[model samples]
Target: MLYLFGAIALFVIFDSVRGYLKTEDKRKYLVRLFLELTVVIGLLFLFGPLFVLSPLKIGYSTLKEGNITLYYPGGSIDMARDVMEQLKQAAEMNRQFYKANYPMPVVLAQSEFDMLRFGSYPYGGGTGSELSLNIRAGQMTTGKIAHEMSHRNLAMLTGKSMPAPNWFNEGLASYIGKMDEYKKPNELQVDLREGRYVRDILEMRGILGTPKWILKIRQGKGRVLYGQTYLMVKYLFDKYGQEKVYDFVVSLKTNDFEKAFWQSFGMSEEEFFQEFTSYIQNYRGEPS
Candidate 1:
């Protein structure tokens, strides 16, 4: 509807300009064009912040405590309070991991459509920025919030213009959130053995640049990519220690991620990938 309305507005402006160019009655055209423009502008103002107005339409209520602000549907105050608590806990966990604190906004969406209204991906949960999350209203959980909070914390710790590689970014989050234990080492070993996982680390750099990654998630093929990345990050933290990893992430604020990786880890990304890939391929454990 917004696109359609914008197209109509463009047509109106074009038609008005053409009429002004051709008109013998200049004063009449000027007056008519002014009115048309006024109407279009008025409608634009009315519709521009539709997402802001949606809360009122849905009888949503706001809750605030310290740095966390939550918007939830009316009659769900109890649930909203629970979400706020979860956010607080998630924030604390991230603060301990990152050694810093940041404020975040959370929206408890009654449905995926509600999540979309707030510019959040509606698949279970999503974040709009380093400091905002939209979660399916009733499905909020510790692991999910932790996952998103890790993303937010890392974003806060690093430069936005040049982000860390996709694999590192998501792998760190999944590792911190502890959400991929279900993926299982045996399953990853199968993917590795079958040549189904990411073959090159460069391919993992911007994996989310295409819609196919999300499609893979929906098709239940995400475990391979996510699981492999998680293990890779786990490998870094385990072998290099947390402080070194922290230094690398913090260096991103001043350096390109590749430069930071070299400075802190003492190796190129390819070197690390080769090391990690070999490690994971040889990792064997009883299936969980």
Candidate 2:
């Protein structure tokens, strides 16, 4: 589009110059040239950032460190190194817990939205494929790195085309990284007392299907949804154990939720949901 606009502008300018030199009336030609220039400038202003033509002096290097190769991209290299080290530790922890032999590389990018957008692509974060960790200068904490590494581990374990539901996936990631610990039950109780819990998941399920759901959840309304999901996954882990949950997650990699639920724990979805709801309502145990 920019190219076509540029060509048209050039032709208009050349014609206008010819009209100014050879014809009696150059005012109309000048007006046409000005309009063409305006259109060209508008196109450039609108499309310039979209093109990313700034050469993006981004550099990346792969280093084989222990069990994983860290793919580090430009922008705070020191922070990127720290994130990689943290991810390695987390990956090792997950490997020990799951006893899985497969280890894949971790690719750390420079943008959080870029990592999420990459994962948003069709099969972007697949098994034996790369997982992107967006590193911000002051924001890349150990907990955040662990959380992202957990995502990579889950992706590898699932080997599915699309990720599992955000509730399960994000809840588990949040749990692994200890982000859930920040949410005191009292805080949630306050929300519940204030009638802010949004009690029914069905009411907000449509928003869950949209891309903005993450932001919505981060904005606090997502709390009720994630809190419930966290409780549900914690219930599964508590009732069946982490190994069982791991088996269930691995099953989900190849099978649907219903099939995986039954195969992993010998219960149907309806039965599991019933038990899960019961556990959430009655389980008075401390948060894991």
Candidate 3:
């Protein structure tokens, strides 16, 4: 009905215009009216879907191949389905890896980035929410999908109650996304030796407080930070053991990072940071 109402209104306007134009020749007046109406109809057809002028429900837009449902005002159904399926698979894998039972439904939006940017967001992908992937970024890589899925799984495992620190959240996501493999130690070492580190993970912990900073890093220098965070999480798991890692994740859910860290590793944040930093420096060794 909204569309019907709009069509009716258009017709009324056109008829009023036709009446006012009192052309002496009936044939000429009819021809002019027909041309005007045709132009209006053509414009409506071109832009109607874009604006969702009609409140008609595009019921159950299902992508069977992807095994996902896409709720959108308008788009290519086939492409949306494909993206949804890939994201579902990625989310499932993350859920298994983290052992999160209550997996939240993923929401997809068409934006410049495939994944949702962090900050004060409410409805879809925002603070205190589970996984929300941007459809645009979904087209880029399955890795991006995995990264956001990690966020969702983490949120669910913790009952969406406890808030995780920046390092832990981004690090866990980057780790699950398998970004570490993309950053070989040899390459990183070479960069370090040449004093050309692209992004310092420790530095980003401070800089990533703002949305603009986060967006910049995610698009530009942030890739390097992701690699570093992945490495840090991996190192933590390898050094402290997966059981400890599991406990830390649990503590994160319970909002007891201090207790969790101390209980599992017998160290506070300062101690752990000092040790971990030393360990990284030692492993890398002085250049020359």
Candidate 4:
């Protein structure tokens, strides 16, 4: 905010001096500058610190693909193109993995400020075929986009034919996004190694509705939730591969993820959850 004000002040002074020196009527362009400055400042405040409204007011270019469209600012053409390529690659990968071509997600990124408009947004998130994504203006990373696309592809792949219980949405996304790919030890493992871990999936597995519990938002507990679910999904995916787990998601359309669990992994939820916790307890860092 200080920088913004300082910039405005500098512009105002420069414009004032330019009008005085270059124009017969110094007050004329000075007045115009003041009006323009007012509008710009109003927009800046109205749009928050992110300048989201600047591009919105100015309008942005759109890039269209088979099933995706990227809305981006003119200055971000190169960055936007890069993201487009990545999305296309992701779509192709999803096609091979799902055995079906679904409506790919719409990718939109202009600035982090534009992304901040999303309520409670953390980097980016996707639902079905719509994606709200964020990038660092001229930069792109694989964290949030990968995770959200994990949710999107599965949702679209199943379409209306299969309605997953949605318990493992984030976990499933993290699994497909390959959070482990970065080779960063998860918070769960770090805490466990430090002997500070206390939450027990084994005890809570059957008592709490897995879907309800997983879906619930408890501030500051996202790591625990994501860690446990990611490990569980990783186990399932590694054991049965992507196709089998997708079949299990399809089976969940009947709202019987319990039955799907058995069919997919041949184990009850409680047993599986307990086994997963036990595995983490005995196994070394990171899941193989």
Candidate 5:
């Protein structure tokens, strides 16, 4: 839709310029050009930041360190430096943990409003190679940086077209980022006991990392989904070890995720899910 709108706007501008060059009526051409320009500006407002020209809407200072490049607005250079350092640490941690490296472009939004204007929220978002973070939202942490970088790293390693399951992606990222620690054990216990936790395997596998899922987090229902998946990945890590997990992620480059899982873990994903949920249910102690 953005592309189509852009093409139409360009055509309108081109045609208007041609008409102005040839036509004898300068007054009429000026009127038409004003209307056409208005339409183009209106289209930009309608499309918001998803339009290709969205990045140009803000003035960003660039900072580079290794494979990471930071873009931050004015008056936030200190925060940008902090973000760059954290991002560097996160990338190194991911490489050590997952044995994967990917170039990342990080955007530090000075406020929630800036974040929203950039097509993200206060928390932050990872769209494959790029990450947007709201540094002023009091949500910035090393774990959060690691979490988004994990997503980008996996996307690079696995290939975006056939990426792993959303639940796995989010869970592993949460585990790596330590975002799971935000949810208290007692709180998770209440969720599990009150039947508010993820139950169906299909539900777990289909859990998305989109904005709607973020809305669920805002509504207080997302903790279970995120918490459960984090525990799931943590469970595998505790039982199998990071080497097996790394192998599984690396195998995703060639094999389907389920196939890679079975080859790496000696159990089907369904079997693992059953075992994990049962472990959660039968354990006589605090979960995780």
Candidate 6:
């Protein structure tokens, strides 16, 4: 549409110039040229930014580091480097943990709305086929980006999405991403002892597949739930080791979830929960 407008505007200007040459009418030619320029510039100003940016273009600039490519708006050059290195290190860590060599695109959005505009929210994540992270402005954290990157690693390692409770996915992302970095260990102990940080997986199940649940989680439930899920995943991963963790994730889409987990961990959800309940009650701080 802009191109069509531009072409027509150009024609008007040229015709006006031709008329000026033929008749020497200076004001007529000037008015026509001015109007044409004004309309053309208006069209360019109105739609130029949108046409040049994603979903049409990824960003205003690009930077490459290892297997990661960063797309972000103009800002501090040094900050972009720092952000890239931070996420690259994170992607590398997830790769090492899961034995994944997959690549990912990291998009550092200028704002929450910018993140959404590029199809990257609620915060960050990547699907199997494409490893990527879309982070909102000022939300940079190793755990946050790592959590999303881990999902891509999982998909790359398995070559497909896994079928499992959303909890397991969140747990895996949280655990490997090192969510404990933001946690106040002593405060966690206090929360647990005060019955404020209880891990109520049963209650969590009731909220799934609902819009209200998404809103709640996005608003605040994620903080508590991620902490709870992180601890549970850490316990399981530590017990079974890395390869087994990979086995467990891939198996989710291949077999009965219960059966797959049982085969991988040698326990059912009932038994696992019983043990987890006991462990959390006495939890003090980070494990040595």
Best by TM-score: 1
Q: What is the TM-score of each candidate against the true structure?
A: 0.77, 0.60, 0.60, 0.60, 0.72, 0.66
* Candidate 3 displacement at residue 64 in angstroms: 8.5
Clashes of each: 0, 0, 2, 0, 0, 0
Worst 10 residues of 1 by lDDT: 46-55
- Per-residue lDDT over 43-64 for candidate 1, one digit per residue giving the tens place of the 0 to 100 score: 4333222333333434667898
Cα lDDT tens digits for candidate 2, 80-167: 5676677676666666545663465554544545443333222222112223343343444565556556666776677642346555
Count of backbone collisions within predicted model 4: 0
Which candidate number has the best lDDT? 1
lDDT of 6 at 163: 42
What lDDT would each prediction earn against the true structure?
0.70, 0.55, 0.54, 0.57, 0.68, 0.63
Worst 10 residues of 4 by lDDT: 124-133
Clashing pairs in 1: none
Choose 2 or 6, whichever is better by TM-score: 6
Which ranking of candidates, highest lDDT first? 1, 5, 6, 4, 2, 3
**What's model 2's TM-score?**
0.60
Each candidate's root-mean-square deviation in Å?
5.6, 10.9, 13.1, 13.2, 6.7, 12.6
Off by over 4 Å in 4: 1-58, 105-107, 111-113, 118-140, 160-167, 181-190, 193-225, 284-288
lDDT of 5 by residue, 1-288 (tens): 233445776997788788889989899979978987787675554443443234453466778898876766766678777777788888777888777567776666556565655555545443323233234423567776787778777867776533577668878888888787645445655667888866653343322335446666677776687787788888899999988888888888889877888899999888998887677666667534
Name model 2 segments beyond 4 Å from true: 1-57, 73-77, 101-131, 184-194, 198-212, 266-288
Q: Tell me the tens digit of each residue's lDDT in model 4 across 1-288.
A: 233345778987886787679988767877977798788667654453333324453445777788766656667677778888877766555555566655553435444446554311334343222233334444433544556565566655554312343336656766755566422335556656775443554333322343344444444445666666677778887778888887787776554556777877888877876776576667666444
